[model samples]
Target chain A: MRNTQVIQVEGLTKKFGDFVAVDHISFEVEKGEIFGFLGANGAGKTTAMRMLTGLSKPSSGKGKVAGFDVLKESERIKERIGYMSQKFSLYEDLTVKENIRFYGGIYGLSKNQIRTKTSQILEELQLSEVGAKPVRSLPLGWKQRLAFAVSMVHEPEIVFLDEPTGGVDPNVRRQFWEAIYQASELGRTIFVTTHYMDEAEYCDRISIMVSGMIKALDSPDNLKKQF
Target chain B: MRRLRFLIQKEFIQIFRNKALLPMMTLLPIIQLIILSNAASNEVKDVRIAVVDHDQSEISRALSNKIMANDRFSLLAAPFNKKEALDLMQLDEVDIVLEVPPDFEKQLYRGEAPQLQTLVNAINGQQATVGSGYLNGIIATLNKEIRRNEPLFFSGLPKHNEPVVVTSNNWYNPELDYPHFMAPGILAELTALLTIVLTAMNTVREREIGTIEQINVTPIKKWEFILGKLVPFLCLGLVLLTVGLIASKLIFDIPIRGNIGLIFAYAVVNLICVLGFGLLISNFAETQQQAIFVAFFFVLIFVLMCGLFTPIDSMPKWAQYATIPNPLAHFISVSRKVLLKGSGLADIKMEFVYTFILALLFNAAAVWSYKKQE
Candidate 1:
């Protein structure tokens, strides 16, 4: 519970009826760090992520994300964070630029701010050529990149990406990782979940969950040596 | 306001661009308006009748001739036996059967009253009663003729007999033209259909496509998100109302005697109630198909209970009270009053208040049902 810790959880648990998706798990993600959350299918990675992102409430325990109380200040926490799902989530019917504008507007950016940031993001992602095209027409890799950029349009303090590169090719995945690195270099924290073990090496710190509990938390190299 | 404007723009583009939705949204309403209008007529015409003549006398033949001359009833075939008449009724070929009993002429001449048996199919009870009235009139005329020629002494006749003295004045719809009654109703129906589908589909579609979570994590307040989804459909509903009104005036020549402004105002209020219901359905449903099914069930019930097919006054006492909160009933009653009966706001003030209060109540329920988290 240092001031520098962006996300602090103590015995965070979620239960749907009698089933416990995420048991009493405790972890902290530091500011400006790429923290990888790894778990098997249905291993409570998503449930824990939902609670931390303020999308779902924990049945027991307490947590804080970005200096806001998870239960009472959920909306305030939402305003400071961005989220992207496993699916390349963007409005398929809207153009890339329109999607960015919509998300930026909802994040309370002024019209001028949206315009400026949209141009910059499009340029940074090398999407200037197809920015006017519908998101559905873009390749899966491009849509994922655009979604990531759209999530960060308001320049939130942190971004949560749940399996952000699920179905893309290896070359595209490499490029997507570069974008993540670029965001981290800009002093933004990245909370990412993935099943690909190799992707865990790219994170500064990694946590592996098994049966609703965090079994290991360390650098990929340290985790390998310990095992 | 700016966030809502952007969301509205996005929704409109999605609706306009979808290939399957464009035709369904635009063409379906027009086609339903034309077809249902024709089927909605209350004027009964071309009734079929089977005659069973047990007596081949001149009086029996004369009775058949009078029924045929009335222009309402069409004789199905030559006189059949009693068995044949019952067979035709069971086969659904004829709606009514006229049985002329044996010795009918002998009983009339012997100073005794003769009864002509009229057996009617009462499946559609209203039509059956009207048909029976027509048949009884023909037999009464035959009795008068028999009395006039013979000059028989009848001492105990009812005193309240006035010949040829029946007149009918149908209120609201003088001609009872189906289109005149149905066009306004269909317009109201279209509002409910379109608003429910659009609003309910708005959030659920986002959930399916994965954008809902992204938006949820943004700074957008819940009310802003909900309003963003609602305002576009409200505008579209108004546009549809205008198109329907123009079609009513130009194509069908449906009169609009009340204030046009008042009608438009009522339409706006009614849209709120429908859109609110749509939002509530969207919140409860986890998928697009579920939202659609839920909305369809409510719309079907609403249309049935709205007094479109049955008179509100004639409904059972409990059912009549239940329809008071159904916005469709209020809108239909107000539209019929304004367009057909030429009623002013003063005449339909109660209906207006009912619609307005229900709209607010439904919207409140919708806002309450929407959760800020999960």
Candidate 2:
């Protein structure tokens, strides 16, 4: 497999009328790399993430996500990447297995592929017992982990997780990180944004965005020495 | 196409998961459709009459024959005594009572006026007034015939002092069954209510639960998402509309005068106009409660101004003109003309054109309001 840049940006800026949400920011992530985006609250981390995910229009600058243009190629970007927002974005009304099947099916998976993935995910996540029950009945930690797994069901090139471990217990968060590393082993690039500084250690290289601009881009040891 | 099937499947599951909302969406509109259509009629058909004939002569029998033959009055019991006639009137079985006095023909032959006593139950003023007028008409004709034959008594009387009679024909609704007017209107109301409320609430609910954000980040196009949402409601609305028409036909006996296929086609076109209105409301409203209120506001305007309860011709010219833009009004008019009159496509071609344009306009507006990258 070619180890090339999966995400390349020159200067991506998003403005809301008089206010600038995401200033001209530039970065790149190699294939299968777990790149961490660290920022304080209101630091335009989300605006940058949205632009990269092709969910929001960039006011200026040019970028390519998963080899697709950020402008005029958003649909292609969506097909190539998986996204999980901070809101525990799963169908609470749907069962764990059903949620897996639905998300997979929406990515244009065939019936045979959906069936295979459903069983594989159930055993892998150890959610075989409650596959028929609704997601609303599950514990918060379990839901977050299941959400991560569902996001990656279609086996996209990259998984964009925005605060994926928010409000989960320490035990569950550790197990969740184990799965994140496991995903990287399968050559899925992980682009995550988090306020938890400790989570920054898991990245191959971390970029700290302050007020929509990248102030630091280096390994954790280097960043720690500077701070 | 496969993506849309999955998306629509998810929507159906979400809707059915809430046990209460599903039944409420399908049931309330149906109940309202049947009950309101039956209750909307105002034309009075059966007015019972009782005749007390003390003057059992040829004239009295002829008078009784004339009264009974008219469609307005039904003969209850022609009692010989006033007491018996009054008894039937008191029982609420009869609306009018006519009493011919004992000295009937003898007084008229002696060149003296013979009085006829008629009493009307004025409990419902409209029935009482109209009933009495009918009686007066029948008696006046008798009086004119009597005067013409007895020319000796009227030789001194002036001829110009005659009752200037006018005749009227019920051009459209001759039988005056109010159900005929309301069935079409009620069908219009149900389509708007079901389409707007269901679509609005579900759309907003998706936003509230954050599922919309998940779908937004997917490969689904904005127009694809909108179409996926609209197609399900369109299908469900059509099924519900068919059921509503069947019930109207079975319960109220509303005749289907226009093309049966045309009626369904008309409703589908109407759905095209209205389902987008719901989508537009959902796009603007951030919460399900806000969606409900916004939907209610627009649905109320559409239903009330559809001329369902009031006749469009009776409305002010400006308000009548406003109905031009109201989809519900066009629906009601189309249904009534087709169902009751069996009016062909040629007769209702203008309505079809206007509705088609309005539907296209509304759908375009709805699609325009949605932002994939705003």
Candidate closest to the true structure, highest TM-score:
1
Off by over 4 Å in 1: B78-80, B103-111, B137-166
Across B1-374, the per-residue lDDT of candidate 1 in tens digits comes to: 77787877888888788887756666677777777777776556767898888887988888888878978899885456877888888998888998988898888666556777888999988779888887777777777786676664443454344367566898877777789998888778876788788789877887787678777766676777778777878888887778778877877888898888888888888888888889989989889999999988988888998988878899999999999988888888878888988888898899888888987887778878877576
Error of model 2, residue B126, in angstroms: 12
How many clashes show up per model?
Answer: 0, 3
DockQ of each: 0.75, 0.61
Off by over 4 Å in 2: A1-3, B38-166, B169-173
Q: In candidate 1 chain B, where is summed lDDT lowest over 10 consecutive residues?
A: B153-162
Q: Which residue pairs in candidate 1 have backbone atoms (N, alpha carbon, C) closer than 3 angstroms, thus clashing?
A: none
lDDT of each: 0.84, 0.85
Q: Please list the Cα RMSD from the true structure of every candidate, rounded to 1 decimal place.
A: 2.3, 7.0
Candidate 2 chain B worst ten-residue window by lDDT:
B37-46
Clashing pairs in 2: B257-B342, B258-B338, B258-B342
For B1-374, candidate 2 gives per-residue lDDT tens digits of 88888888887787678888656656776788778877665445667889899988888887888888888888888987889888888899899999999878878666466899889999977688888888888888888887887789777766776668778886455666777778778877887788888898888888888888888888876677888888888887887788788878877787786799988888888887888888988999999899999888878887788888878898899999999888888888888888888888888888889889988887787778887666
